[model samples]
Target: MRFIRYVLRALNPKTAVTMDSRQVFRIRRCVVAGVIAVLVIAMVSCGVYGVKMHAQRAAQASQSATSTDKTTAKRQNSKKESSGKQSQKSQDNADTEDSVQAELKNQSASLTDDQRNEILAKAQQTARDNGHEPTQYTYCVAQKGDVGSLDDFANAVYRILNGERGWSRAGATFVQGADGNCDFNIVLSEARYMTTFSPDCSTEYSCRVDENVIINDDRWNGGTNDWLSAGGDMARYRVMVINHEVGHRLGHTDNETTCAGAGQLAPLMQEQSMHLDGCATNEYPLDGELWIK
Candidate 1:
């Protein structure tokens, strides 16, 4: 600025005349060069500032992206954890069920052969001892749709029941096909030496059936077959399932008369969820409920 002022002063008419036209021309050229230099410096400063701002913006964008990635990763981790927990819970439930089923299998197994024979013998003694027959009774067979085949299955049951070790068919008989006045139709759906029912003790029960399925998906580990099937586990379940359903026909019902959500029937009925009653719980007794005067 000072140089420009000085050049203007030198270009004045008085100085121009004192120094002549050549000196005046030189002073004006110097002033113009100074102005161009100032412009170049200003432009450089502006460019540098723009570059700095751009770099700052890029850094900010990178930070924002990093934060978003972390958030997304956290959500994914949480979901995986939740899924893992659910899997663990399901496995635990299965294990608990398995334990219960194992116990039932053991109890059911003990009911066959020698043990069962002993119980049957006791039952006959009780009937003879009590000497009171049910009203209009029949060996009503609650037919199972899938006992493999009915004729063969029924014949097998007849052979087994007849050979019951302790049981005597003294007053007992097999009434086949419903005569007009059939009281009940009982079929040996599955004749496993299953459980020893009370000797001469008769229990009558009734229950409401929930979702009945053709396929057996019971809770018991032994499934329907292990209970009293003829073929194998599957076949055993088929027979057991039939026996249970037929057991209901024998006058069994849900044990809990007014339970909340069917407290499940006893084993002989559905899941074989129950065990055969001991002699004490049986309805029939050698001595009557009330003394016979």
Candidate 2:
């Protein structure tokens, strides 16, 4: 009010003559309304800016959280894959260990000391009687845990090899020992374990694998039907078995030669134990039949 009165006093009477109380009141009210509208617009602009900034911060926070979640998931997946691979490798190693243990157990169950000694004694005696000079070939003799008398079997093998018309005629002499440094191995195996040494022959027949001659206990104990038909002699069958397996060690393969005549001697390389095929039983190799070079 004071500022208005001062303004009216400063003006001349003629200039202020039209001013009324109501008009002055109306002007004051208009001025107050304009100031309030300006203040309201400024407040509204500040509120809009605040809302925009808050929204931007919220969006940025959401994006960062999403990125963090993806990184964490990838790390977890990598860890799981690595763990899975390690687990599989461990399993494979465990399986290998088990297999080795089983094989060792099987080998450990083989021939006892007493049996080996008996076999050694017999082999020595037989070698004294039948072993010839020049020492052409040496063989290692081994027996399965359940097979009988390695010495007796070794002696039999020696006798056959040094017989009148045996491998000795071909200038090849065989000696028996347990040492690994032998030219060939003659293993007396039980029927149950034959396939372990001779996978090709399985259990049906004796076989030669590498330089190892595997002999089946079943055939040794009981002569085959062909041998029985000829003479029912266990001795002749033993001779045949030794010669056949040793023939394989001497670079001979399975020979399907049938007997030439009903009474002729079967070829030493023939599968005589299975079938004579109309041949007489002949344990010793015929003259010039050594075929060893």
Candidate 3:
């Protein structure tokens, strides 16, 4: 510092020839002092700048460390979630497999002999009752020998129980044809009709279970069976068959619709008079239980 100040002062003649030799020396001293002040200011500025740069670096490092910790925590959490989902999926699959296995073990294809009979009997009874029985429902089949019996019976059956109240509100009106013939008519397509089994099952057929049995015609064209073939039951033919079929309306299947048929035959919901294979409403004891309460 002294060397610098001396060089600066030596160049100034005015400074060398001061008011006093002492003053000249003072000028040189002042220059030296100024130089020292400048040096001191530079050192202080450098120290302050170094401190600020170090603080900035430290803050950056801290931020980076914090960011790294957050990244690691997120990765661990994602891994844990993935593991939990895999475990849950495996458990659900196991449950589904167990359910399928359990279901597979419960069913068999073969039916018991009793069960077969039950099915047949149930079908016959259901079909007949659904076709023939009305509370006071009647089907007009004239004397057994009449060829037009089917027509008359169809009429009565339709008139009484073809619409809604075939069983409750339905009633049959028997009308006699010119040649001692009969016909049963059905007004509604949905009305039930009665006929004998196809020898595969000898007796019951059809039920008039609905309250709305309606007849739209004076002729009996639907519901054909063999009872009309054998001329036998006489006037009872109409009533007996009606009764047997009605038994189904009261809810018994083939096991129940019985009266009597050819050769000491038990009448079921059979066109009773012709084959003596069945009975009419009068043949079966009228049960109050048969009426819908």
Candidate 4:
């Protein structure tokens, strides 16, 4: 600024006349050079400031990108962890169900020929040893729908009915007569046909209407979920249902009785199909239930 003021003073007419033409020309040249140098310095300073601003902007952008990447990675890792936990829980539940199914499979195995024969012999001897004349009750086996293996079903009925722990203990013995020629009917029918016998009968369970001892084939094959869950097998379920339904034919009503206590045998007349109510599964009649008639 001082140099600019000095140049302005020198350009005045009086000052220029005092100085020689050469000095005047030199001052003029110096003034122009000084203005150009000032402009150059200002431009250089602006350029440096621009460069610094650009560098700061680039650094900020890079930091933002890095922060976004970290956030996304954290979310992905969290999702993977949640999915892994869900898969593990599902696998554990499936494993437990499979174990229970395997146990039921092992328990459902039928008796061998020798075993059947031995049990039948003992049951017959027990019936005879009761020392009372066996009250004869002729019955017939019939089917409403395709009940699968008529012989197998008939044989099971015969064995269970005449078993030592059956109604035989009460001097009641069942005999299968010719078709349509019997005192009572033990009908093995499909689930859909169960309600046809009477409105009181249901597809979910067995029922006895008059002389018809209706057995639901579904229950015969699959058994009840309640019974199976209570550690009961298909074979024992068959025994219980047969006795339960036949007990109705022998003048017993749907008692819907509960267990005497925990760990005690459930009453054969109890609705073991629905729930055990803290009782163990039982297949035969108790002493009090033997004389239903």
Candidate 5:
């Protein structure tokens, strides 16, 4: 108002040419008011611009913070999902191991206490029967039909013959040799060819004909019903069949031995493949049947 009033007065004809002291004072006052007005406008404009700029910066910071929070949440969720999957996989493996152990336990429980104790005692005694003269025997493997890998079969045969639990503990050491050069022939024959060895050899079982130890591929692949019923698997059935047929070569007759007692281990000379006769299925030779003639 001061600046505008002074401008109006200076523009009037009465005050335009006048040089009075009062007019000079009025001009100075108007100049000061105009300078104050310019300063006030500049301050107000800068204040408004500063407020707008501050608001825009706050909005940007808010958006950035929200994005950062989302990213953190996603990382946390991903970690949780990975951890859950790993935990579930570990749990599944543990369950499988537990299931296998439970099955083994149930199979072990099928034996009577007396039979179990007797078997354990026999095993302990056999462990001490080690210092006898070792007899070395060479054997060859022959296969009929598809019996998987012959190399694997031969390896298993050698392992069974010379294994600690097999005839090896009886002081017999076995080596694989070429055909006709071996002391005995271990044959893995198909079920159809089992009877070719002799009429006594059947399609469902293994047999010994002089120097030939014929094994039924069907029984080798699938264990006997009696053995399986007695809580034995195919691997153990193979061990029993090999030892039993070879026991014939070792001077043991089939009828000479049977299950020692009810719930006792079937002797290696027993026809365990045909029947257990209420005895538990056993593969290795017992203490009394360990020596070769």
Candidate 6:
């Protein structure tokens, strides 16, 4: 009330008028209420703005965290995929190796030392009994990749060449080993390795490529149908193969001759492996005409 009276006095100092005290008091109350209302509104606006800004920051932080998690997951997934591919490649390589080993095991054959020694002994004895001048040859039995025993093959070749009814009758002889000058090389090779000697010859047949008497491993293991049909004698076929190839080495050409008679022996120069026709199988040079003059 005193403050209102002072304000009123300052405003109307010159005019000394009679005013109601209640009206002055009502004016002062209205002014005070207006001021208080403005202050409350300012404080509420500041608090609302602050809360909005804090919410925005929190939302932004949450979005950033979500993006970071996604990036980490992508990286982890990529690593797992790369590791899986490498593991598959390693497994594939291991499988391929195992397959190769199995194939080799199936194709290979084994030969013993005792069997080789016996074959060598028999071949040497046969050479001595054939009554021919000693001719020298280098005999080597080879295989491509672990196919069979070299010793047994070498002995078989020696036995074939030194047989009583074979080249011995032609006065040609063979000395074992490469120490002496070799007239020719008798190579007993596996079927897979036959191409090394005679590139044009098939594994089903024997050939004389240059000075090499290339005998096929397949034919050595299995006899020809013609010989089997006649007597089922593998020995006879073995003898025939030896004579045929050796004949080529001794300047005998492919005769392609048939049997003169139905019961006669087939010519030694004939391709008996193909067919015997009506003739019996012959392993030797008949009529004493094959001798070296």
Best by TM-score: 4
Write one digit per residue (lDDT tens) for candidate 6, span 1-293: 98767666644635324556666566657767978999999999999999999999999999999899999899998999898999999998788657644543432324365654564455555545655554544544444545466655555555666565666656655535664346666666677777766568877777888777777767766868876776534555666787788778787766645567777888888777777777887877764435542
Better of 1 and 4 by lDDT: 4
Candidate 3 has an lDDT of 0.42
Q: Runs in model 3 with CA error above 4 Å?
A: 1-7, 10-21, 101-293
TM-score of 5: 0.56
lDDT of 6 at 72: 89
Could you give the candidate ranking by TM-score, starting with the highest?
A: 4, 5, 2, 6, 1, 3
Return model 2's CA RMSD, one decimal: 19.6
User: Across residues 1-293, which tens digit of lDDT does each residue of candidate 1 receive?
Assistant: 98666676776777566665777788777767878889988999999998999998998998888888889888998988898999899998688657655643443342345654464455445435545331212343343233344444444333333322211222232233444345444432222211222222112221223211112223222442223322223333334444334334434343412211233222333223243222111211111121111
TM-scores for every candidate against the unseen true structure: 0.37, 0.52, 0.31, 0.58, 0.56, 0.50
The candidate maximizing lDDT is 4
lDDT of 5 by residue, 47-163 (tens): 999999999999999999999999999999999999999999999979865775564344334434464445444434443577666677778888877777666566566556665
Count residue pairs with overlapping backbones in model 5.
Answer: 0
Give the TM-score (vs. native) of candidate 4: 0.58
Candidate 3 residue-wise lDDT, 1-293, digit = tens: 98666555554786556436675677668879988999999999999999999999999999999899899999998999998999999998788657644432322123355643453344334435545342232333322222333443443333323222223222221222233232332222211222221223222333343421132111122223444344322222333344445545445444444454334444343433333443322333233223332
lDDT of each: 0.40, 0.71, 0.42, 0.82, 0.76, 0.66
Estimate the lDDT of model 1: 0.40
Off by over 4 Å in 1: 1-33, 93-104, 110-293
lDDT score of residue 77 within candidate 2 = 91
Q: Can you give the lDDT of residue 5 in candidate 1?
A: 66
Candidate 2 stretches with Cα past 4 Å from truth are: 1-135
Answer with 3 or 5, whichever has the higher lDDT.
5
Model 4: lowest-lDDT 10 consecutive positions? 102-111
Question: Which residue pairs overlap in candidate 6's backbone?
Answer: 135-173, 136-175
